[model samples]
Target: MPYVLLAAAIAAEVGGTTAMKYSEGFSRLWPSIATVIGYVLAFALLAQVLKSMSVGTAYAIWAGVGTASIAVIGMLFMGEAAGVARISGIALVIIGVVLLNLGGSH
Candidate 1:
């Protein structure tokens, strides 16, 4: 299903972003390679998903989910601040994504 592919794409994008944190500005070899591979796979999957899905819907979900996931990852695992503003921003992103999907479905 296209949704499955889109989920995979989102996962790949999240992986790539996580790897980027460990990539040390691309100075590290394995993490850098992982980052590149993850991003490539993500785009490939996303491109496939676009064939059956609306671009606006797919892209909105992709960007929003990736962003929210990264923020949570940073807070929980990466020692980033979990301040109220940041959490609220993430919530707003989710809300916006939901609104976009709802609006696009009709």
Candidate 2:
């Protein structure tokens, strides 16, 4: 399904972003490879989702979810800061994504 494809894309993007942090300017071969592969799969899956979803809707969801997920992953795993303000901002992004999806379904 398109939604499933979109979810996979989001996950792939998150994985890519997380790996990218560990890539150390692409010096770490394994993580760098993983980052590339993950990004490729993410885009490929996004293209599939675009076959059924509106470009605007799908793109918004992809970007919103990918960004939020990556931020959370970075905060949790990469020791990146997750202050209250940042968390609130991420929450707003989630709210916006939900609204976009709801509006798109109608």
The most accurate candidate by TM-score is 2
lDDT of 1 by residue, 1-106 (tens): 8889989999999999999999999999999999999999999999999999899899989999999999999999999999999999999999998898778632
Off by over 4 Å in 2: none
What's the CA RMSD for each of the models? 1.3, 1.2
Model 2 agreement with the true structure over 66-105: per-residue lDDT tens digits = 9998888879877999999999999999999999988973
Point out the worst 10-residue segment of candidate 2 by lDDT: 97-106
Clashes of each: 0, 0
Q: What TM-score number comes out for model 2? A: 0.94
Structure candidate 2, residue pairs in collision: none
lDDT of 2: 0.91
